[model samples]
Target: MAKRASRRSAAEDPSWACPCGTGLPYADCCGPVHRGEGTAGTAEALMRSRFSAFAVGDTDYLLRSWHSSTRPARLRLDPGQRWIRLEIVATERGGLFDSTGTVAFRAHYREAGRPGTLDEHSRFVREDGRWVYLDAQPD
Candidate 1:
């Protein structure tokens, strides 16, 4: 036989803090969610993971976590935009037992060396027992 493969998988770098600003290492936070090892347990958890996904440019996770009713056919993240920070403004329901929730947040980024912020109130609901992004509420 040619060389046998090692059973150990490449571990995520533990030095990097999670992009969601949770103060936890990436591997112990969004890394597992991105790897499909687990899902967000609550709507707020899902929101945090989604923000981290944008920072890391994981379009697949963004689409997958989106509600089918509102998910777009495709998504294109801007390569020049670097997501730098996330500030959760508030949360409505979307807890461990609730089926629906809303997350109000501000996502800060820098594009072409210019800083900007996006504020939105996102809707979320349980789809087949999993929390998924529904849409944004009208301001």
Candidate 2:
């Protein structure tokens, strides 16, 4: 059977801050992107939304935003794992005008009663006029 999209509503509390460390409320930030109501304007914004998608178990959004060449046939999120925070270390040319860019980030998570961090430098490219995740490189 195909995996069903998550049922959790993306219309989170309007006052709740977005999980992407953007300080803005979910409704004003990544929420719109996740809902398909809007598109991220830059690679960094897309990267931030992807992180938020993981945090909320939005696998559908993750797959949709991933570049087709690298996108997997299926995505599985560990129910025992909880993504806690994101720290963007750096970005290169992922602005509104760049066709390609990179973002270095550390994602902190806790799973199986242990804490860990995933450090990666991810690449993004414009696909059909939208930014999509291509792959990751060692940080």
Candidate 3:
């Protein structure tokens, strides 16, 4: 079997801001999470990290942060699709004290030079002491 590629740090530039809209440097925000040096402290944080993963093509991070029941064996990112921005719309109960939560957001992207957006309300759960993505609520 071929060895899966590990997630590389998206923070190649020390001064780049995090794609998660945290207003923090990539190294201070999602980069540590992507690098396995830390974990997201809340469901919202997990959601943000996952979005950053998509933006940076960190498939391993995406898989690790996904709940096993809903996690796929592999993830493929479209190189043609460039994630540009994220707009958080709402969050429900996915706090430090809560075991589960939901986040609604709009992810802006560009594909083949055309712009688009994906709006979703994602569910998250705390499993084995970490927040992991569960599923997206059906529209």
The candidate scoring highest on lDDT is 3
Candidates' C-alpha lDDT: 0.88, 0.89, 0.90
TM-score computed on alpha carbons, candidate 1: 0.90
| Candidate 1 residue lDDT tens string, 12-98 | 567778888899977899889988899899998999999988888889999999999889999999888978889999999999999
> Worst lDDT window (10 residues) for model 1?
4-13
Task: Give the residue spans of candidate 1 off by over 4 A.
Answer: 1-11
TM-score quality measure for candidate 3:
0.92
Model 2 score (lDDT): 0.89
Please write out the lDDT profile of model 2 over residues 50-136, one tens digit for every residue.
Answer: 999898889999999999999999999998887878999999998899999999999999999899999999999999999999999
**Candidate 1 residue-pair clash tally:** 0
C-alpha RMSD (angstroms) for model 2: 4.9
**What lDDT is reached at residue 33 by model 3?**
91
Q: Considering only N, C-alpha and C atoms within 3 Å, which residue pairs clash in candidate 3? A: none
